[model samples]
Target: MGTLDEIKAALINLDIPQVQCKIHQGLAEGLSPSAILEKSLIAGMNTIGSRFKEGDFFMPEVLVAAKAMHTGLDILKPLLTAVENRVKGTVAIGTIKGDLHDIGKNLVIMMLEGAGFEVVDLGVDVPPDKFITAIETHHPRVVGLSVLLTSVMPQLQTTIQQLEPYRRELYIVIGGAPITQQYADKIGADGYAPDAASAVDKVRELIARN
Candidate 1:
Protein backbone atom coordinates (compact mmCIF):
# COMPACT_ATOMS: atom_id res chain seq x y z
CA MET A 1 0.00 0.00 0.00
CA GLY A 2 0.98 3.63 -0.45
CA THR A 3 2.37 5.69 2.42
CA LEU A 4 -0.85 7.62 2.87
CA ASP A 5 -2.85 4.37 2.90
CA GLU A 6 -0.49 2.89 5.46
CA ILE A 7 -0.88 5.98 7.61
CA LYS A 8 -4.65 5.72 7.34
CA ALA A 9 -4.60 2.07 8.38
CA ALA A 10 -2.35 2.81 11.31
CA LEU A 11 -4.67 5.59 12.43
CA ILE A 12 -7.69 3.28 12.25
CA ASN A 13 -5.81 0.75 14.33
CA LEU A 14 -5.16 3.49 16.92
CA ASP A 15 -1.44 2.74 16.77
CA ILE A 16 -0.25 6.12 17.97
CA PRO A 17 3.51 5.43 17.97
CA GLN A 18 3.42 3.81 14.55
CA VAL A 19 1.26 6.58 13.14
CA GLN A 20 3.65 9.23 14.39
CA CYS A 21 6.62 7.38 12.87
CA LYS A 22 4.86 6.96 9.54
CA ILE A 23 3.92 10.65 9.41
CA HIS A 24 7.58 11.55 9.93
CA GLN A 25 8.70 9.11 7.25
CA GLY A 26 6.10 10.48 4.85
CA LEU A 27 7.29 14.03 5.50
CA ALA A 28 10.90 12.95 4.90
CA GLU A 29 9.80 11.37 1.62
CA GLY A 30 8.55 14.80 0.47
CA LEU A 31 4.89 14.27 1.23
CA SER A 32 3.30 17.56 2.23
CA PRO A 33 1.84 17.84 5.73
CA SER A 34 -1.40 19.05 4.18
CA ALA A 35 -1.59 15.98 2.00
CA ILE A 36 -0.82 13.66 4.91
CA LEU A 37 -3.55 15.27 7.02
CA GLU A 38 -6.17 15.22 4.28
CA LYS A 39 -5.43 11.76 2.91
CA SER A 40 -4.54 9.91 6.08
CA LEU A 41 -5.59 11.49 9.33
CA ILE A 42 -8.74 13.23 8.19
CA ALA A 43 -9.68 10.34 5.98
CA GLY A 44 -9.31 7.84 8.81
CA MET A 45 -11.28 10.00 11.23
CA ASN A 46 -13.98 10.47 8.65
CA THR A 47 -14.30 6.73 8.39
CA ILE A 48 -14.41 6.35 12.13
CA GLY A 49 -17.00 9.08 12.50
CA SER A 50 -19.18 7.57 9.82
CA ARG A 51 -18.92 4.14 11.42
CA PHE A 52 -19.84 5.66 14.74
CA LYS A 53 -22.91 7.35 13.27
CA GLU A 54 -23.88 4.10 11.61
CA GLY A 55 -23.43 2.16 14.86
CA ASP A 56 -20.71 0.03 13.34
CA PHE A 57 -18.02 1.56 15.55
CA PHE A 58 -18.67 2.37 19.19
CA MET A 59 -17.36 5.18 21.36
CA PRO A 60 -14.27 3.27 22.47
CA GLU A 61 -13.15 2.69 18.89
CA VAL A 62 -13.73 6.31 17.91
CA LEU A 63 -11.93 7.59 21.01
CA VAL A 64 -8.85 5.47 20.38
CA ALA A 65 -8.72 6.49 16.72
CA ALA A 66 -9.01 10.13 17.74
CA LYS A 67 -6.11 9.62 20.17
CA ALA A 68 -3.98 8.15 17.38
CA MET A 69 -4.85 11.05 15.10
CA HIS A 70 -3.66 13.45 17.82
CA THR A 71 -0.35 11.60 17.96
CA GLY A 72 0.20 12.07 14.23
CA LEU A 73 -0.88 15.70 14.51
CA ASP A 74 1.76 16.26 17.22
CA ILE A 75 4.44 15.26 14.75
CA LEU A 76 3.04 17.52 12.02
CA LYS A 77 2.22 20.54 14.19
CA PRO A 78 5.78 21.86 14.30
CA LEU A 79 6.17 21.59 10.55
CA LEU A 80 3.12 23.80 10.08
CA THR A 81 4.57 27.25 10.61
CA ALA A 82 2.28 30.11 11.52
CA VAL A 83 1.67 31.05 7.90
CA GLU A 84 1.19 27.45 6.75
CA ASN A 85 -1.12 26.78 9.65
CA ARG A 86 -3.36 29.67 8.70
CA VAL A 87 -6.02 27.65 6.99
CA LYS A 88 -9.14 28.60 5.03
CA GLY A 89 -10.64 30.11 8.16
CA THR A 90 -10.92 30.11 11.94
CA VAL A 91 -13.71 28.42 13.93
CA ALA A 92 -14.68 28.78 17.57
CA ILE A 93 -16.58 25.97 19.26
CA GLY A 94 -18.16 25.16 22.61
CA THR A 95 -20.80 23.14 24.35
CA ILE A 96 -23.77 25.30 25.30
CA LYS A 97 -24.45 26.52 28.84
CA GLY A 98 -25.48 24.05 31.53
CA ASP A 99 -24.44 21.05 29.43
CA LEU A 100 -21.23 19.38 30.49
CA HIS A 101 -21.02 16.69 27.81
CA ASP A 102 -17.92 17.07 25.66
CA ILE A 103 -17.11 13.91 23.79
CA GLY A 104 -19.11 14.98 20.75
CA LYS A 105 -17.78 18.51 20.95
CA ASN A 106 -14.21 17.22 21.17
CA LEU A 107 -14.69 14.99 18.14
CA VAL A 108 -15.94 17.89 16.07
CA ILE A 109 -12.97 19.98 17.17
CA MET A 110 -10.56 17.27 16.04
CA MET A 111 -12.31 16.91 12.70
CA LEU A 112 -12.28 20.67 12.15
CA GLU A 113 -8.58 20.88 12.94
CA GLY A 114 -7.87 17.92 10.70
CA ALA A 115 -9.74 19.65 7.89
CA GLY A 116 -7.26 22.55 8.25
CA PHE A 117 -9.30 25.13 10.08
CA GLU A 118 -7.83 26.68 13.20
CA VAL A 119 -10.20 25.75 16.00
CA VAL A 120 -10.66 27.47 19.35
CA ASP A 121 -12.39 25.05 21.68
CA LEU A 122 -14.27 26.84 24.45
CA GLY A 123 -14.99 23.60 26.33
CA VAL A 124 -18.29 22.48 27.92
CA ASP A 125 -21.10 24.27 29.75
CA VAL A 126 -20.23 27.57 28.12
CA PRO A 127 -22.58 30.51 28.56
CA PRO A 128 -23.88 32.91 25.90
CA ASP A 129 -21.68 35.66 27.22
CA LYS A 130 -18.68 33.41 26.75
CA PHE A 131 -19.67 32.81 23.14
CA ILE A 132 -20.12 36.52 22.64
CA THR A 133 -16.78 37.23 24.25
CA ALA A 134 -15.07 34.61 22.13
CA ILE A 135 -16.61 35.91 18.93
CA GLU A 136 -15.61 39.45 19.78
CA THR A 137 -12.13 38.39 20.79
CA HIS A 138 -11.31 35.81 18.13
CA HIS A 139 -13.29 37.23 15.19
CA PRO A 140 -13.63 33.73 13.81
CA ARG A 141 -15.36 33.11 10.51
CA VAL A 142 -17.58 30.49 12.08
CA VAL A 143 -18.87 29.46 15.51
CA GLY A 144 -20.11 26.02 16.56
CA LEU A 145 -22.28 25.05 19.53
CA SER A 146 -22.67 21.56 20.90
CA VAL A 147 -25.50 20.48 23.18
CA LEU A 148 -25.92 16.81 24.06
CA LEU A 149 -28.74 17.14 26.52
CA THR A 150 -32.32 17.87 25.49
CA SER A 151 -32.48 20.20 28.45
CA VAL A 152 -29.80 22.43 27.01
CA MET A 153 -31.54 23.18 23.71
CA PRO A 154 -32.79 26.44 25.16
CA GLN A 155 -29.21 27.42 25.80
CA LEU A 156 -28.55 26.99 22.12
CA GLN A 157 -31.46 29.32 21.41
CA THR A 158 -30.07 31.86 23.84
CA THR A 159 -26.66 31.72 22.18
CA ILE A 160 -28.20 32.26 18.75
CA GLN A 161 -30.24 35.12 20.10
CA GLN A 162 -27.13 36.72 21.53
CA LEU A 163 -25.38 36.29 18.22
CA GLU A 164 -28.19 37.52 15.98
CA PRO A 165 -26.77 41.02 15.72
CA TYR A 166 -23.66 39.66 14.06
CA ARG A 167 -25.42 36.82 12.28
CA ARG A 168 -25.22 38.56 8.96
CA GLU A 169 -21.46 38.16 8.87
CA LEU A 170 -20.83 35.25 11.22
CA TYR A 171 -21.75 31.68 10.46
CA ILE A 172 -23.16 29.67 13.37
CA VAL A 173 -23.21 25.88 13.40
CA ILE A 174 -24.73 23.53 15.98
CA GLY A 175 -24.53 19.81 16.72
CA GLY A 176 -24.73 16.96 19.25
CA ALA A 177 -27.02 14.04 20.14
CA PRO A 178 -30.30 15.91 20.58
CA ILE A 179 -29.73 18.53 17.88
CA THR A 180 -31.44 17.99 14.55
CA GLN A 181 -31.56 19.95 11.33
CA GLN A 182 -35.04 21.07 12.23
CA TYR A 183 -33.87 22.18 15.63
CA ALA A 184 -30.97 23.99 14.03
CA ASP A 185 -33.29 25.80 11.69
CA LYS A 186 -35.66 26.60 14.51
CA ILE A 187 -32.85 27.99 16.57
CA GLY A 188 -31.58 30.01 13.57
CA ALA A 189 -28.31 28.09 13.35
CA ASP A 190 -26.61 28.39 10.00
CA GLY A 191 -25.95 24.68 9.83
CA TYR A 192 -26.37 21.42 11.72
CA ALA A 193 -24.12 18.38 11.71
CA PRO A 194 -25.31 15.01 12.97
CA ASP A 195 -21.77 13.77 13.52
CA ALA A 196 -18.17 14.84 13.44
CA ALA A 197 -17.59 13.75 9.82
CA SER A 198 -20.61 15.72 8.66
CA ALA A 199 -19.45 18.66 10.77
CA VAL A 200 -16.28 18.85 8.69
CA ASP A 201 -18.32 18.88 5.51
CA LYS A 202 -20.74 21.46 6.91
CA VAL A 203 -17.94 23.76 8.01
CA ARG A 204 -16.34 23.51 4.58
CA GLU A 205 -19.61 24.44 2.96
CA LEU A 206 -20.08 27.36 5.33
CA ILE A 207 -16.58 28.64 4.58
CA ALA A 208 -17.17 28.28 0.88
CA ARG A 209 -20.28 30.41 1.14
CA ASN A 210 -18.57 33.08 3.18
Candidate 2:
Protein backbone atom coordinates (compact mmCIF):
# COMPACT_ATOMS: atom_id res chain seq x y z
CA MET A 1 0.00 0.00 0.00
CA GLY A 2 1.03 3.61 -0.40
CA THR A 3 2.44 5.46 2.59
CA LEU A 4 -0.74 7.48 2.92
CA ASP A 5 -2.89 4.37 2.84
CA GLU A 6 -0.64 2.69 5.37
CA ILE A 7 -0.91 5.70 7.59
CA LYS A 8 -4.70 5.68 7.31
CA ALA A 9 -4.91 1.97 8.13
CA ALA A 10 -2.56 2.32 11.05
CA LEU A 11 -4.61 5.21 12.34
CA ILE A 12 -7.88 3.30 11.93
CA ASN A 13 -6.33 0.41 13.80
CA LEU A 14 -5.36 2.83 16.58
CA ASP A 15 -1.69 2.03 16.07
CA ILE A 16 -0.21 5.30 17.29
CA PRO A 17 3.43 4.24 16.87
CA GLN A 18 2.83 3.08 13.32
CA VAL A 19 0.98 6.26 12.54
CA GLN A 20 3.94 8.33 13.70
CA CYS A 21 6.40 6.11 11.84
CA LYS A 22 4.50 6.17 8.55
CA ILE A 23 4.08 9.92 8.73
CA HIS A 24 7.84 10.27 9.05
CA GLN A 25 8.30 7.82 6.21
CA GLY A 26 5.89 9.81 4.07
CA LEU A 27 7.94 12.90 4.74
CA ALA A 28 11.17 11.11 3.84
CA GLU A 29 9.51 9.90 0.63
CA GLY A 30 8.90 13.58 -0.35
CA LEU A 31 5.24 13.73 0.62
CA SER A 32 4.18 17.21 1.68
CA PRO A 33 2.84 17.76 5.18
CA SER A 34 -0.49 18.97 3.84
CA ALA A 35 -0.81 15.77 1.80
CA ILE A 36 -0.13 13.68 4.90
CA LEU A 37 -2.76 15.63 6.85
CA GLU A 38 -5.59 15.64 4.30
CA LYS A 39 -4.95 12.29 2.61
CA SER A 40 -3.98 10.24 5.65
CA LEU A 41 -4.81 11.62 9.10
CA ILE A 42 -7.98 13.44 8.14
CA ALA A 43 -9.10 10.61 5.89
CA GLY A 44 -8.62 8.09 8.69
CA MET A 45 -10.55 10.25 11.14
CA ASN A 46 -13.39 10.43 8.65
CA THR A 47 -13.68 6.65 8.68
CA ILE A 48 -13.53 6.53 12.44
CA GLY A 49 -16.26 9.13 12.66
CA SER A 50 -18.44 7.18 10.24
CA ARG A 51 -17.91 3.98 12.22
CA PHE A 52 -18.94 5.74 15.39
CA LYS A 53 -22.07 7.04 13.70
CA GLU A 54 -22.85 3.54 12.38
CA GLY A 55 -22.57 2.00 15.89
CA ASP A 56 -19.65 -0.21 14.85
CA PHE A 57 -17.32 1.87 16.99
CA PHE A 58 -17.76 3.17 20.53
CA MET A 59 -16.25 5.99 22.52
CA PRO A 60 -13.07 4.16 23.51
CA GLU A 61 -12.31 3.16 19.95
CA VAL A 62 -13.03 6.60 18.66
CA LEU A 63 -10.86 8.18 21.34
CA VAL A 64 -7.90 5.95 20.57
CA ALA A 65 -8.29 6.59 16.85
CA ALA A 66 -8.37 10.28 17.57
CA LYS A 67 -5.13 9.96 19.49
CA ALA A 68 -3.48 8.18 16.58
CA MET A 69 -4.76 10.84 14.22
CA HIS A 70 -3.44 13.61 16.46
CA THR A 71 -0.09 11.84 16.70
CA GLY A 72 0.18 11.88 12.92
CA LEU A 73 -0.88 15.52 12.87
CA ASP A 74 1.75 16.49 15.45
CA ILE A 75 4.44 15.16 13.13
CA LEU A 76 3.10 17.06 10.14
CA LYS A 77 2.14 20.38 11.76
CA PRO A 78 5.63 21.80 11.97
CA LEU A 79 6.49 20.91 8.42
CA LEU A 80 3.50 22.57 6.80
CA THR A 81 4.25 25.82 5.04
CA ALA A 82 2.28 28.98 5.75
CA VAL A 83 0.12 28.54 2.68
CA GLU A 84 -0.51 24.88 3.44
CA ASN A 85 -1.58 25.74 6.96
CA ARG A 86 -4.58 27.74 5.84
CA VAL A 87 -7.78 26.58 7.56
CA LYS A 88 -11.24 26.35 6.00
CA GLY A 89 -12.73 28.40 8.85
CA THR A 90 -12.86 28.80 12.62
CA VAL A 91 -15.37 27.23 15.03
CA ALA A 92 -15.80 28.04 18.70
CA ILE A 93 -17.27 25.13 20.70
CA GLY A 94 -18.31 24.56 24.29
CA THR A 95 -20.63 22.71 26.60
CA ILE A 96 -23.40 24.93 27.90
CA LYS A 97 -23.37 26.14 31.50
CA GLY A 98 -24.65 23.62 34.10
CA ASP A 99 -23.59 20.82 31.76
CA LEU A 100 -20.23 19.43 32.77
CA HIS A 101 -20.15 16.77 30.08
CA ASP A 102 -17.36 17.15 27.54
CA ILE A 103 -16.80 13.84 25.79
CA GLY A 104 -19.19 14.85 23.04
CA LYS A 105 -17.73 18.32 22.78
CA ASN A 106 -14.20 17.01 22.59
CA LEU A 107 -15.18 14.53 19.91
CA VAL A 108 -16.75 17.26 17.85
CA ILE A 109 -13.61 19.37 18.18
CA MET A 110 -11.46 16.49 17.00
CA MET A 111 -13.69 15.86 14.01
CA LEU A 112 -13.75 19.55 13.13
CA GLU A 113 -9.99 19.78 13.31
CA GLY A 114 -9.59 16.67 11.22
CA ALA A 115 -11.85 18.25 8.65
CA GLY A 116 -9.38 21.19 8.37
CA PHE A 117 -11.19 23.81 10.44
CA GLU A 118 -9.52 25.62 13.31
CA VAL A 119 -11.35 24.88 16.57
CA VAL A 120 -11.56 26.99 19.71
CA ASP A 121 -12.42 24.74 22.62
CA LEU A 122 -14.28 26.74 25.29
CA GLY A 123 -14.47 23.72 27.58
CA VAL A 124 -17.21 22.53 29.94
CA ASP A 125 -19.66 24.64 31.94
CA VAL A 126 -19.28 27.56 29.54
CA PRO A 127 -21.55 30.47 30.28
CA PRO A 128 -23.17 32.41 27.48
CA ASP A 129 -20.99 35.41 28.17
CA LYS A 130 -17.94 33.25 27.72
CA PHE A 131 -19.20 32.16 24.33
CA ILE A 132 -19.81 35.79 23.52
CA THR A 133 -16.24 36.59 24.49
CA ALA A 134 -15.01 33.77 22.26
CA ILE A 135 -16.90 35.20 19.36
CA GLU A 136 -15.63 38.69 19.99
CA THR A 137 -12.05 37.54 20.45
CA HIS A 138 -11.77 34.70 17.96
CA HIS A 139 -14.24 35.99 15.38
CA PRO A 140 -15.23 32.45 14.48
CA ARG A 141 -17.51 31.79 11.52
CA VAL A 142 -19.39 29.07 13.42
CA VAL A 143 -20.39 28.60 17.05
CA GLY A 144 -21.12 25.17 18.55
CA LEU A 145 -23.02 24.55 21.80
CA SER A 146 -23.22 21.16 23.48
CA VAL A 147 -25.57 20.19 26.29
CA LEU A 148 -25.88 16.73 27.79
CA LEU A 149 -28.49 17.32 30.44
CA THR A 150 -32.19 17.72 29.75
CA SER A 151 -32.54 20.13 32.65
CA VAL A 152 -29.75 22.32 31.28
CA MET A 153 -31.31 22.49 27.84
CA PRO A 154 -32.70 25.86 28.73
CA GLN A 155 -29.14 27.15 29.02
CA LEU A 156 -28.74 26.50 25.32
CA GLN A 157 -31.66 28.77 24.50
CA THR A 158 -30.44 31.42 26.90
CA THR A 159 -26.98 31.35 25.37
CA ILE A 160 -28.37 31.67 21.89
CA GLN A 161 -30.47 34.60 22.98
CA GLN A 162 -27.41 36.34 24.41
CA LEU A 163 -25.66 35.82 21.10
CA GLU A 164 -28.53 37.30 19.12
CA PRO A 165 -26.69 40.46 18.18
CA TYR A 166 -23.95 38.44 16.52
CA ARG A 167 -26.46 36.18 14.81
CA ARG A 168 -25.87 37.75 11.46
CA GLU A 169 -22.12 37.43 11.77
CA LEU A 170 -21.96 33.70 12.56
CA TYR A 171 -23.88 30.46 12.34
CA ILE A 172 -25.00 28.67 15.52
CA VAL A 173 -24.95 24.87 15.64
CA ILE A 174 -26.16 22.90 18.64
CA GLY A 175 -25.78 19.25 19.69
CA GLY A 176 -25.56 16.77 22.57
CA ALA A 177 -27.58 14.03 24.23
CA PRO A 178 -30.71 16.05 24.92
CA ILE A 179 -30.54 18.30 21.86
CA THR A 180 -32.71 17.73 18.79
CA GLN A 181 -33.52 19.36 15.49
CA GLN A 182 -36.85 20.56 16.85
CA TYR A 183 -35.16 22.06 19.90
CA ALA A 184 -32.61 23.75 17.67
CA ASP A 185 -35.30 25.28 15.52
CA LYS A 186 -37.38 26.29 18.53
CA ILE A 187 -34.36 28.00 20.02
CA GLY A 188 -33.53 29.68 16.71
CA ALA A 189 -30.30 27.81 16.10
CA ASP A 190 -29.00 27.66 12.56
CA GLY A 191 -28.30 23.93 12.54
CA TYR A 192 -28.40 20.72 14.57
CA ALA A 193 -26.07 17.70 14.63
CA PRO A 194 -26.92 14.33 16.08
CA ASP A 195 -23.27 13.51 16.75
CA ALA A 196 -19.71 14.61 16.30
CA ALA A 197 -19.46 13.38 12.71
CA SER A 198 -22.65 15.17 11.78
CA ALA A 199 -21.38 18.32 13.46
CA VAL A 200 -18.51 18.59 10.98
CA ASP A 201 -20.85 18.12 8.04
CA LYS A 202 -23.29 20.68 9.42
CA VAL A 203 -20.54 23.22 10.01
CA ARG A 204 -19.23 22.73 6.50
CA GLU A 205 -22.68 23.14 5.04
CA LEU A 206 -23.35 26.31 7.05
CA ILE A 207 -20.05 27.81 5.98
CA ALA A 208 -20.70 27.01 2.34
CA ARG A 209 -23.94 29.00 2.30
CA ASN A 210 -22.12 32.20 3.15
Candidate 3:
Protein backbone atom coordinates (compact mmCIF):
# COMPACT_ATOMS: atom_id res chain seq x y z
CA MET A 1 0.00 0.00 0.00
CA GLY A 2 0.97 3.65 -0.34
CA THR A 3 2.66 5.44 2.57
CA LEU A 4 -0.42 7.48 3.46
CA ASP A 5 -2.62 4.39 3.26
CA GLU A 6 -0.19 2.47 5.46
CA ILE A 7 -0.23 5.27 8.02
CA LYS A 8 -4.02 5.30 7.98
CA ALA A 9 -4.26 1.53 8.41
CA ALA A 10 -1.76 1.54 11.26
CA LEU A 11 -3.80 4.20 13.05
CA ILE A 12 -7.04 2.28 12.51
CA ASN A 13 -5.37 -0.81 13.95
CA LEU A 14 -4.25 1.25 16.94
CA ASP A 15 -0.62 0.61 16.07
CA ILE A 16 1.02 3.66 17.61
CA PRO A 17 4.55 2.58 16.75
CA GLN A 18 3.67 1.97 13.15
CA VAL A 19 1.82 5.26 12.98
CA GLN A 20 4.87 7.17 14.20
CA CYS A 21 7.21 5.25 11.95
CA LYS A 22 5.03 5.79 8.90
CA ILE A 23 4.68 9.47 9.71
CA HIS A 24 8.45 9.76 9.73
CA GLN A 25 8.71 7.66 6.58
CA GLY A 26 6.06 9.75 4.85
CA LEU A 27 7.99 12.88 5.72
CA ALA A 28 11.25 11.32 4.49
CA GLU A 29 9.55 10.43 1.22
CA GLY A 30 8.63 14.08 0.59
CA LEU A 31 5.08 14.07 2.02
CA SER A 32 4.00 17.32 3.61
CA PRO A 33 3.02 17.35 7.29
CA SER A 34 -0.43 18.63 6.42
CA ALA A 35 -0.90 15.86 3.88
CA ILE A 36 -0.03 13.16 6.41
CA LEU A 37 -2.34 14.75 8.97
CA GLU A 38 -5.44 15.34 6.86
CA LYS A 39 -5.08 12.39 4.52
CA SER A 40 -3.85 9.76 6.95
CA LEU A 41 -4.30 10.56 10.63
CA ILE A 42 -7.59 12.41 10.44
CA ALA A 43 -8.98 10.01 7.85
CA GLY A 44 -8.15 7.10 10.16
CA MET A 45 -9.92 8.77 13.08
CA ASN A 46 -12.97 9.40 10.95
CA THR A 47 -13.03 5.69 10.16
CA ILE A 48 -12.83 4.91 13.86
CA GLY A 49 -15.83 7.17 14.46
CA SER A 50 -17.75 5.30 11.80
CA ARG A 51 -16.80 1.94 13.26
CA PHE A 52 -17.95 3.05 16.70
CA LYS A 53 -21.23 4.23 15.28
CA GLU A 54 -21.71 0.94 13.47
CA GLY A 55 -20.95 -1.09 16.62
CA ASP A 56 -17.88 -2.57 15.01
CA PHE A 57 -15.71 -0.78 17.56
CA PHE A 58 -16.18 0.19 21.20
CA MET A 59 -14.77 2.73 23.63
CA PRO A 60 -11.53 0.87 24.19
CA GLU A 61 -10.84 0.56 20.48
CA VAL A 62 -11.79 4.17 19.84
CA LEU A 63 -9.67 5.47 22.70
CA VAL A 64 -6.62 3.50 21.57
CA ALA A 65 -7.04 4.73 18.02
CA ALA A 66 -7.31 8.27 19.33
CA LYS A 67 -4.07 7.76 21.20
CA ALA A 68 -2.35 6.61 18.05
CA MET A 69 -3.70 9.65 16.22
CA HIS A 70 -2.34 11.87 19.00
CA THR A 71 1.07 10.26 18.69
CA GLY A 72 1.06 11.03 15.00
CA LEU A 73 -0.06 14.59 15.70
CA ASP A 74 2.70 15.15 18.24
CA ILE A 75 5.29 14.06 15.72
CA LEU A 76 3.85 16.38 13.11
CA LYS A 77 3.36 19.37 15.42
CA PRO A 78 6.84 20.78 15.08
CA LEU A 79 6.81 20.55 11.29
CA LEU A 80 3.27 21.89 11.01
CA THR A 81 3.93 25.46 12.03
CA ALA A 82 1.40 26.81 9.55
CA VAL A 83 -1.44 24.60 10.78
CA GLU A 84 -3.29 27.63 12.10
CA ASN A 85 -3.65 28.93 8.58
CA ARG A 86 -5.41 25.69 7.63
CA VAL A 87 -8.09 25.98 10.34
CA LYS A 88 -11.57 25.77 8.88
CA GLY A 89 -13.03 27.83 11.73
CA THR A 90 -13.27 28.05 15.47
CA VAL A 91 -15.74 26.15 17.67
CA ALA A 92 -16.27 26.50 21.39
CA ILE A 93 -17.60 23.39 23.20
CA GLY A 94 -18.55 22.63 26.77
CA THR A 95 -20.58 20.26 28.86
CA ILE A 96 -23.66 21.96 30.31
CA LYS A 97 -23.90 22.93 33.98
CA GLY A 98 -24.66 20.11 36.46
CA ASP A 99 -23.26 17.63 33.96
CA LEU A 100 -19.78 16.40 34.73
CA HIS A 101 -19.65 13.85 31.96
CA ASP A 102 -17.05 14.86 29.38
CA ILE A 103 -16.29 11.65 27.50
CA GLY A 104 -18.59 12.61 24.69
CA LYS A 105 -17.54 16.23 24.79
CA ASN A 106 -13.90 15.25 24.66
CA LEU A 107 -14.48 12.98 21.70
CA VAL A 108 -16.15 15.82 19.85
CA ILE A 109 -13.19 18.04 20.55
CA MET A 110 -10.85 15.44 19.08
CA MET A 111 -12.94 15.12 15.96
CA LEU A 112 -13.13 18.90 15.53
CA GLU A 113 -9.39 19.22 15.87
CA GLY A 114 -8.84 16.37 13.44
CA ALA A 115 -11.14 18.12 10.99
CA GLY A 116 -8.83 21.16 11.17
CA PHE A 117 -10.95 23.49 13.31
CA GLU A 118 -9.52 25.45 16.20
CA VAL A 119 -11.50 24.10 19.16
CA VAL A 120 -11.89 25.99 22.41
CA ASP A 121 -12.60 23.41 25.08
CA LEU A 122 -14.81 25.01 27.69
CA GLY A 123 -14.53 21.96 29.97
CA VAL A 124 -17.12 20.39 32.29
CA ASP A 125 -19.94 21.81 34.45
CA VAL A 126 -19.83 25.02 32.50
CA PRO A 127 -22.41 27.59 33.56
CA PRO A 128 -24.25 29.84 31.15
CA ASP A 129 -22.13 32.82 32.10
CA LYS A 130 -18.97 30.90 31.28
CA PHE A 131 -20.31 30.17 27.84
CA ILE A 132 -21.19 33.82 27.45
CA THR A 133 -17.67 34.71 28.47
CA ALA A 134 -16.27 32.30 25.93
CA ILE A 135 -18.42 33.79 23.19
CA GLU A 136 -17.19 37.25 24.08
CA THR A 137 -13.60 36.10 24.12
CA HIS A 138 -13.40 33.62 21.25
CA HIS A 139 -16.18 34.88 18.99
CA PRO A 140 -16.51 31.40 17.47
CA ARG A 141 -18.89 30.80 14.63
CA VAL A 142 -20.36 27.73 16.36
CA VAL A 143 -21.05 26.74 19.97
CA GLY A 144 -21.67 23.18 21.19
CA LEU A 145 -23.24 22.14 24.47
CA SER A 146 -23.19 18.60 25.81
CA VAL A 147 -25.41 16.96 28.43
CA LEU A 148 -25.43 13.34 29.49
CA LEU A 149 -28.34 13.43 31.87
CA THR A 150 -31.99 14.07 31.17
CA SER A 151 -32.21 16.08 34.38
CA VAL A 152 -29.58 18.53 33.20
CA MET A 153 -31.25 18.90 29.79
CA PRO A 154 -33.01 22.07 30.84
CA GLN A 155 -29.62 23.68 31.27
CA LEU A 156 -29.20 23.44 27.52
CA GLN A 157 -32.27 25.55 26.96
CA THR A 158 -31.20 28.00 29.62
CA THR A 159 -27.76 28.33 28.09
CA ILE A 160 -29.27 28.86 24.66
CA GLN A 161 -31.52 31.54 26.10
CA GLN A 162 -28.50 33.28 27.60
CA LEU A 163 -26.83 33.18 24.21
CA GLU A 164 -29.83 34.55 22.30
CA PRO A 165 -28.21 37.91 21.77
CA TYR A 166 -25.39 36.30 19.82
CA ARG A 167 -27.72 33.99 17.96
CA ARG A 168 -27.66 36.18 14.89
CA GLU A 169 -23.99 35.55 14.25
CA LEU A 170 -23.47 32.22 15.98
CA TYR A 171 -24.86 28.75 15.45
CA ILE A 172 -25.69 26.57 18.47
CA VAL A 173 -25.37 22.79 18.27
CA ILE A 174 -26.28 20.30 20.99
CA GLY A 175 -25.44 16.65 21.64
CA GLY A 176 -24.78 13.97 24.27
CA ALA A 177 -26.33 10.83 25.73
CA PRO A 178 -29.73 12.39 26.36
CA ILE A 179 -29.69 15.03 23.65
CA THR A 180 -31.74 14.55 20.49
CA GLN A 181 -32.88 16.51 17.49
CA GLN A 182 -36.27 16.95 19.11
CA TYR A 183 -34.65 18.39 22.22
CA ALA A 184 -32.42 20.60 20.08
CA ASP A 185 -35.43 21.87 18.12
CA LYS A 186 -37.37 22.51 21.32
CA ILE A 187 -34.43 24.46 22.68
CA GLY A 188 -34.02 26.28 19.33
CA ALA A 189 -30.56 24.93 18.62
CA ASP A 190 -29.41 25.50 15.07
CA GLY A 191 -28.13 21.92 14.71
CA TYR A 192 -27.80 18.57 16.47
CA ALA A 193 -25.27 15.76 16.16
CA PRO A 194 -25.61 12.23 17.48
CA ASP A 195 -21.89 11.44 17.52
CA ALA A 196 -18.44 12.95 17.32
CA ALA A 197 -17.99 12.52 13.57
CA SER A 198 -21.38 14.08 12.97
CA ALA A 199 -20.41 16.95 15.24
CA VAL A 200 -17.44 17.75 13.02
CA ASP A 201 -19.66 17.63 9.96
CA LYS A 202 -22.34 19.76 11.63
CA VAL A 203 -19.81 22.36 12.71
CA ARG A 204 -18.29 22.43 9.21
CA GLU A 205 -21.74 22.85 7.69
CA LEU A 206 -22.61 25.65 10.11
CA ILE A 207 -19.32 27.43 9.48
CA ALA A 208 -19.99 27.44 5.77
CA ARG A 209 -23.16 29.45 6.25
CA ASN A 210 -21.39 32.01 8.41
Q: Which number leads on TM-score?
A: 1
The pairs that clash in candidate 3 are none
Ranking by TM-score: 1, 3, 2
Ranking by lDDT: 3, 2, 1
Q: Looking at model 3, how many pairs of residues clash?
A: 0
lDDT values for all models: 0.85, 0.86, 0.87
State the weakest 10-residue window (summed lDDT) of model 2. Answer: 76-85
The lDDT, on a scale of 0 to 1, for candidate 1 is 0.85
Which regions of candidate 1 fall more than 4 Å away from where they truly are? 50-58, 80-87
Model 3 per-residue lDDT tens digits across residues 1-210 = 999999999999899999999999999999998788778987788788788889999989988987897788788765675655576778999999999988778878866776578899999999999999999999999999999999988888889999999988789999997877887888899999988778888988888884
Q: Is candidate 1 or candidate 2 better by lDDT?
A: 2
Better of 1 and 3 by TM-score: 1
Between 1 and 2, whose TM-score is larger? 1
TM-score each candidate.
0.84, 0.77, 0.80
lDDT of 2 by residue, 1-210 (tens): 999899999999989999998988888999877777778876787788788889999989988987786677666655653544669899999999998988778878866776678999999999999999999999999999999899999888899999999999999999997788998999999999987667888999999997
